[model samples]
Target: MSLFEELLKWDKDQCRVVGKKFELGSWNKLSEKDRLGMIGELIDLLCQRLKIKDKPKVILTTLDNAFGAFSPSENTIYIDRKTLSKGGILTACYCST
Candidate 1:
């Protein structure tokens, strides 16, 4: 299976095994626009850390079940809204990279 498909399957499995939900901090309590801005900043930090010349496109989606995924072919990163809502930006960022 493709990477995306594998990620999707993993996410589905994760949803079935629930533990304590992620906590939302003050930073995560910000407005949607502000949160997206934070995500952009995180992406910049990730690119710098990874020393990637061509930065991948970052997309936040409510439809996706996964916390985050990187598509090498599209050079894009997908982060789930649920993750951000749960104050999981750092987790998502690490996973994406």
Candidate 2:
């Protein structure tokens, strides 16, 4: 199955496997650059699939209520750092979707 498809099959707790597939080790072991790069790749993948010409910017922050949010007005996607720290890129991608 495609990575995205595999990701969709996962629950929040099982999402760390997605990071391992990308050779990111564990979420805590991932570096900032790698995390951002993964997010960028997922966003690009999503945009390409949707035929979206303008890719949105990704912002990582601490959030209490949400895992991620996409703002069409600013063409930006905001991801909670806690999600990354705990669930890794797969969870981020799932949240973005």
Candidate whose lDDT is highest: 2
How do all models score by TM-score? Answer: 0.57, 0.61
Residues 1-97 of candidate 2: C-alpha lDDT, one tens digit per residue: 6766864654554344343445434545667777777667766666665568999998998877988888989998888887776654554443332
Candidate 1, lDDT over the whole model: 0.59
Q: Which stretches of model 1 miss by more than 4 angstroms?
A: 1-24, 90-97
Clashing residue pairs found in predicted model 2: none
Candidate 1 per-residue lDDT over residues 1-97, each given as its tens digit: 6655654434433332211122245455577667777666655654664557898887888655678888999998887888766676644422321
Colliding pairs, model 1: none
lDDT measured at residue 60 in model 1 versus the true structure, 0 to 100 = 80
